[model samples]
Target: MSEVGMNKRVMLVEDDLDLAVLIQDFLERYEFTVSVVSDGQDAVTRIIAEQPDLVILDIMLPGLSGMEVCRQVRQQYEGFILMQTALDDDIDQMLGLELGADDYVIKQVQPRLLLSRIRALLRRAAPLQFASSEQQSFDYQFGALKIDLTRRMVLLYGQPVELTTAEFELLCLLAKHCGEVVTREDIIQQLRGLEYDGLDRSIDRRISRLRKALQDDAKEQDQVIKTVRGKGYQLCIR
Candidate 1:
């Protein structure tokens, strides 16, 4: 069944016709206005022109490749990016995150789960849209790290820091519980709507990447987000 009054826009970049059709059909049913581009070059051009709310990108695309597309678009587009690809290798995943992808979903994902991820990203993007005046200004300043929730922007030492979607959400979650330990279980549930089985290391990888972006030297003194050995991660800014 299609959702009512959900006018969120999405751009889907895939070379596979069958898969693209399947995704478009399913998302349209849920009230998303999706635009399709089969090649990376076209994806970049349209993205710059339209500025969709979210972009679903394929890693392997004709012409420029998905990685190239993401790199180019990141320079101008500030919308959410979800990388959906058939290549599920660790290197691919790491590259996607390093290139500023918001989320990475391997191909053959259940439509329901994919839809949930889409909804989650959109929700994070507009967290305080419906909140009261007091709640509307959602900004967190911790030492050199200043987070402007309304603009979905983060700054480190007064310089802008570009964070992927997942990284930003992790920061937000920690800030909401500032000075409290946010376990891995809670992080997985909040970001991916998945239960942490104590085996997945994706969250840890994200933390490492985020630390580098925030200039937190893990080898020296852990201050930004400190690890509690076995418990979880805490955002400590002093």
Candidate 2:
């Protein structure tokens, strides 16, 4: 059992009353203060009003689907989002992450693991004290690649590059620390709110997709993203 004094605040959006109550009870024991809501719309409203530290959002709900709820949360709420989704819905999970959700867990996951996930997310969202202030907004130029964080724009060979939300976030993390090898775990922590057990493949897929949009041709052409075998990834820029 967890001490109430050390409890972290959580907003839970789930339609299943029994599940919701059970989760509240269990998390409370872990020293978490949970505010439960049954509908998606209500969840969205309470998120801004309450400004809780974290949100446990289901993938399906009444009035607004869980996906839509996640979208709304991303647009306004800067807090971490842990999406509860059904098993075997890889596509939906990917979509959720792309839409700005931090991490996803199978609905029937062990309560202990769920708690662990919550803690992990909190640690990631917590700001790094040593992060350079100049890191906030800067223009990085490498060869024909130019990235402007203040303007939220990326250019390759003097051509404007379009990126999805997920891809854009990934690029920012990589480009900001150019030429440095970023481990999959660090990348996952930076891009996703929470971490998954088998997400290295997913991050690779996202990097590949981003590379495609950046006009990186692997064969008979130079590319920006350099893959470090058995290590991670590096963005080599001039």
Candidate 3:
């Protein structure tokens, strides 16, 4: 559970009444103020209006469906959206992610795991606080790689980079610790609240995707994200 007194708001858009109640009760107990919207249309409206910190949206919902709801809410809402999906619905899960969902969890999720995921997403959405006043500005730039933290936009070599939520978060994390070898353990812990189990390749896959997006050659010696052999990854900027 997060520290007391900070009641981060969360909205749960699930059509199943029992599941909604269960999730709501659990989240509230963890110090999050949770609101339940059973219908997808209602969720869209309430989300746009209320602008909660995080949204736990079930993919199968009344009226709009989770995919449609995510698409609509993403247009205006800048906060995180954690999609709830069935294990077999990989296509819908991918679609939701492409639609700007921060992450997706299986529908039959344990409350503790859900809470961990929520905390991770919130951490990613949190601002990158730097000690220097000049570094606190909204825009961060290194050579041709530039990021507008407020706008959540990234540009590489004068071209706009279209990145998914996870990809963007990884890029931001790397940029935040530029020139330092951020260990894989730290990366996974900060990004997902899970310890590196030595077999999880998701972060490595994301780094590959980010390298492609940034046009960085992993084969080259000089690039944005450099693999430090056994150490970890480092973001180097001139």
Q: RMSD to native for every prediction?
A: 5.7, 9.2, 7.0
Worst 10 contiguous positions by lDDT, candidate 3: 127-136
Choose the strongest candidate by lDDT. 1
Please give, for residues 88-129, the per-residue lDDT of candidate 1 as tens digits.
575787887778787878888899878877876776554343
Residues 1-238, candidate 3, lDDT per residue (tens digit)?
A: 4442248999999989998999889888878999999999999999999999889999888899999999998989988899988773546656887788878888988988888677766764544443343443446789878887654667665556766566888889989999999989999999889899887667777788788879889988778899987768999994
Put down candidate 2 lDDT per residue, 3-66, tens digits, no spaces: 2224678998999999999999999987789999999899889998888888989988998988
Query: What lDDT does the true structure give each of the candidates?
Result: 0.82, 0.76, 0.81
Model 1, residue 101: what's the lDDT?
84
Order of candidate numbers by lDDT, starting with the best:
1, 3, 2
Pick by TM-score: 1 or 2, better one: 1
